[model samples]
Target: MEANYVSKTAKSMQLHRRAKQVLPAGVSYFIRYFKPYPFYVDWAKGSKIRDVDGNVYTDYWMGHYTHILGHSPSRIVKAVKEQIEHGTHYGVCHELEIALAEQVVKMVPSAEMVRFSNSGTEAAMYATRLARSYTGKNKIVKFEGGWHGGYDALHLAVKPPFELLESNGITDGALRDTIVAPFNNLQETKKRINDKEIAAVIVEPVIGAGGCIPAEKEFLKGLRELCHEKDAVLIFDEIITGFRLAPGGGQQYYGVIPDITILGKILGGGFPIGGVTGRRDIMERMDPLLYERPKFSFQGGTFTANPATLTAGLEMLRNLEDGRVINNLNRHGRRVYRGLEAVFERKKVDAVVNCVGSLFQVHFTREKVRDVNAAYRADKEKLAKYHSALMDNSVFFLPAKNGAISSAHSEEDLEKLILETERFVGESGY
Candidate 1:
């Protein structure tokens, strides 16, 4: 198996070597890099991807969970094609922006008003700023492993060893105002927020990049109550959870509506997009008509409402209105979750698979993974080996990242993944 992978992927290996000279770590995204090297994709369609070496695999990464409808779904492709023919960038107001925004407002419970940005990172940064402007507060409270974006203010404590900065070049001042709290621990979180002038408390309903550990229902409810008491804005960073869990995202699933919600990933119909949505009064702070107002929070981008992205997003949302697609994908995800549990039980492997909606992760531990600290306690080396083994068997899932199921996935795809997982466990001596 190893020899075949190496022989078939010779071209990909050559490309990786060439890419090293130009791209950092031979990959554009840091997470895309792995031990041997990341596969160079030639093309992808539906639920499968083909590498440069003509090696095809069932893809679960699904464009970093952005391709909820799967790679180049016919509807999105047609919409983008028609939109580009008209014009790629208008740099002015277009009807498509209103179309998408209206759809968001109708779907998401708290999205009375909407603002679009280019990426989740940008949207999150703006959400934080808006919170500060609304409450006249300076500090922000975020969960220990909650990953909002790459921005300086909300970038700390995404992973363990919470005392240190997650990345270098972050100034001391940037860290001063950001408070990190223990996820799923109400007492600890309340203590951290006590006496602090918190403008916003941003949290992921399910920790996406950190791990697939879900926030407990009681915990989320407690945070909502705390925010109301403290006069702080509750920001739900639903970049991964939005539209995937349900049409209304995590707030709908948990029945806890936040003051602000940051949405991205699946919302763009396989394009780069992010959105900040909330109450009308709060979002109106960015209204250009309020330019003379001292409380106005400036929010604009070069491609804020580009017609192409909005058109694609609108089409995607239109297709999702029936809710059948999301239901099917989630059903498959539950099947995968059960299959994983069965595999561990059969193989007598001490592992836990955390699953929520259409997302799942394999953690090599017997302990329940409720937070980042518990997730980190898993056997890292064994988990890495399991990921590698799955890849060798022509199944693609990002190492240490959650796997997303799409509506494009078929029963055969699920069966193959289960079989491959069984093989991996049996052969890995776990």
Candidate 2:
């Protein structure tokens, strides 16, 4: 498999060698790196990405699942092009920013106010600080498998061996107040959260980086009650599930509202952006006019609300506001989930498919993958091989990463995915 991939991606191999000389890990993000090097994309359109080697693959990765309407959708491209002519980055406020914020407030169930940032990590960091400021409590409760970016405060125990640090530089003081709780298991989570003065309970409605596992509706409801009982804020990290799940995001999809929503990915409309939004009272903690020093939770940057990002994001939201596009994606998600599961079962492959809305992942394990531990226990090596096989067959899914369905994906694209999986299963003797 490695040799076959290498033969097809000669140009990418050359670029990887060049990239390794400058960029750490030969990539901007470590997660983008894969065995035998990764392909360098020349361009992408609709649901296909063409590598520099001219190999066109049906893309399920979809720019880290950011392109809900598909790569360079005409609407966003047109809006961004016009906005770029005016100004790309304005180190000041603009109507586009206000428009985007208002759109967020109108769409998100709990968003009465919004603040933009550059990425999900920054949004998570800001949300943590704002939670601490609002409640005057230092402790935070996060699920065991929840991945809220690389923020130090909530970064621990994202994978298996849940007691270890996720990275090297994180200090004891940084994670001292962060508590790890079990996902999907409310009783265990409560035991973990017992008597702690939690400022916020942060969770991803559908776990992304940890696995494509979704929180049970009852579990989310339980967390909502728990947070309210403790007078702690309930934060939903809807970065992956934002507009992809519904116009109002996971909060609206699950019918359980949260105090804060951390958004990114599709919210940027394929541009670089992140956002924090919530009820007026909780969100106002970041307002300098409403709160004095020591109380204000600061959140600003040189590109906090860049005009270009806002323009693309605003246009994206306007298209999704009617719910037609989102509902179609959700329908596609269900079809893919059922189709993949049926294919695996027919092949007698002991695999589990985890899915929520437009996101899905295949675990090479017979056991149920309800949480991160189960996901980690799966045959990761086999899963990687399967993904590589799919890629070699011109269906791209980042190895061991969740696959996302976009509006651009057609019935044929989905059929090809299922067929490829079936082929991999039969050939691999799994």
Which has the greatest TM-score? 2
Cα RMSD of all models vs. native, in order, equals 1.2, 0.9
Candidate 1 lDDT over residue span 1-430, tens digit each? 4565677799989999999999989989888988677789989999999999998888889998988888899989997999999999999888889889999999999999999999999999999999999898989998988998899999998887988878899999987889889999999998887787789999999998878989999999999999999999999999999998988888998999999999988788888899999998889888868645687898889998888888889988887776888888888889999999999998999999999989999999999999998889899888787777778878888877889988888899999989988998887777
Candidate 1 regions with alpha-carbon error over 4 angstroms: 1-4, 291-293
- Top lDDT hit: 2
| Candidate 2 lDDT tens digits, 351-371 | 989988889999999999989
For model 2, what is the error of residue 172's alpha carbon versus the real structure, in angstroms, after optimal superposition?
A: 0.4
Model 2 TM-score (2 dp): 0.99
Residue 182 accuracy (lDDT) in model 2? 90
Q: List the residue pairs that clash in candidate 1.
A: none
